[model samples]
Target: MSAPHGINPNIPHSARVYDYWLGGKDNFEADRRVAEQTMAAVPGIRESARNNRAFLGRAVRHLSRLGVRQFLDLGTGIPSQGNTHEVAQAEAPESRVVYVDNDPIVMAHARALLTSTPEGRTAYLEADVREPRTILEHPDTLATLDFTQPIALVMVAILMHISDADDPEGLVKAYAQALPAGSYLVLSHLTLDLIDKRTADDYVAATSSQAMHRTPRTGERISRYFDGFDLLEPGLVAVSKWRETPLFPDEPAWMYAGVGRKR
Candidate 1:
């Protein structure tokens, strides 16, 4: 069957808009329009996007330094600079990464752009985060990752798309259960704490065309995902606050990020 309209260039996609926010050129006019609208609603959106990406890098570096050699990055958007494997393998050439996403466009580019060092491996699975079992059971993932070993599960900027109806907490728990005790769960999600309720509601409504769901969650609610895990230092802070450096200080953003290790 032909790809759906949302996957077509004419339709706006959440991933493409996110890509645009990160200053990427893979998005279409439709994507840019919605992205701009979102920005107008949330002025710090671009900073949030950049900060979220930087958080991914920092978390990956920290995980690599801690000797985590495998990664399962779900909701893998269109291939952008400093992707999961790129950052992880840069720190440890022997790192193995499996990226998962439902978007066919992302899958296509991921196949072309997500290359790895000979000493390591990188594979992309065109699957939805809602189907965690299918992703974890995929043969490519099974071949590349040993479930018994520690793996970093990166869910950056993706959970916001999963509506409350989808049971985001349950999904996290399911994925966590599939990993070993030493595994890590790194995630960044959008919240409305910093913005007015009407503004947050408008932002969520603006992206309704793509069926996007944005939940303005509390720190406590976001922490529920890491229920069984031991949270790292500075637990569940805004994306900008998670290990902020002089280059990127803690600032008010609409997103929260954290990394936790399975006990």
Candidate 2:
């Protein structure tokens, strides 16, 4: 209906703010204002966003190396460095990637930067992660990915926005059920597990807007989101620890990243 809705620049979107934190040029002043406030509350907020982006590339490379050639990346913010298709296709030139997002601005930019290698494919769909059916049943998703084979369902730095009212667990289950046995669920979520309450509250207040509602969960609660799957080595830890090839150590992001396989 009316293409859902157009971009609202007055209100800060979490994705755009995250883009700002990542030093991208696609974000507006409203996003930058909130991002600066979040940084004031939690100084490591920018680092957290950077580490999460790095974790996505590492996880995608690992999965692609393990032979996953298809991907469904949800809540894909404005395309930045080390995007899903780039990382996956780096490991295997024939990788097929499908990106899903609700932001019109992201969709427009996704159309530009989410390209693929000659042997690979990359496509974007403007859809919300809360609606698993629409993403799973979309013609592009069905056509680009083969359910009979293994695929990586990437949910990086996005689930925390799903409030308790939405039954996030049930929604995740629906997506997991649609995948084959060997498919992987790669997710990184914002958490209050390691951060102080003051920082958490202030950070939420600074960033929460009409476009985004913050809900930072605990380590235990975030683990429950992986109930039906078998977690990989080292399990769910900080995003910075998700199988990266060693870099100079950095502060904890207070976010958890994990890769789980549908068993």
Q: How many steric overlaps are in each model, in order?
A: 0, 0
TM value for model 1: 0.92
Score residue 104 of candidate 1 by CA lDDT: 85
| After superposition, candidate 1 runs with Cα above 4 Å error | 1-6, 196-211, 246-251
TM-score of each: 0.92, 0.93
lDDT (10s digit) by residue, model 2, range 1-114: 112256667777888888998889788777778777778767687887888888888889888888999999999999999999998888899999999998898998899878
Cα RMSD for candidates in order: 2.7, 3.0
**Clashing pairs in model 2, backbone N/Cα/C closer than 3 A:** none
For model 1, how does the per-residue alpha-carbon lDDT over 1-263 read when each residue is reduced to its tens digit? 23435567666777888899988888888788888887776667787788888898899999999999999999999888789999888999999999998888888889988999999999889898999889989999999999999999999988888889999999999999999999999998888776677767776776555444556677778889998889999988888777856124434467889999999
Query: Would you list the C-alpha lDDT of every candidate in the order shown?
Result: 0.85, 0.84
Write down the TM-score for model 2.
0.93
Model 1: lDDT equals: 0.85
Residue pairs with backbone overlap in model 1? none
Error of 2 at 58 (Å): 0.4
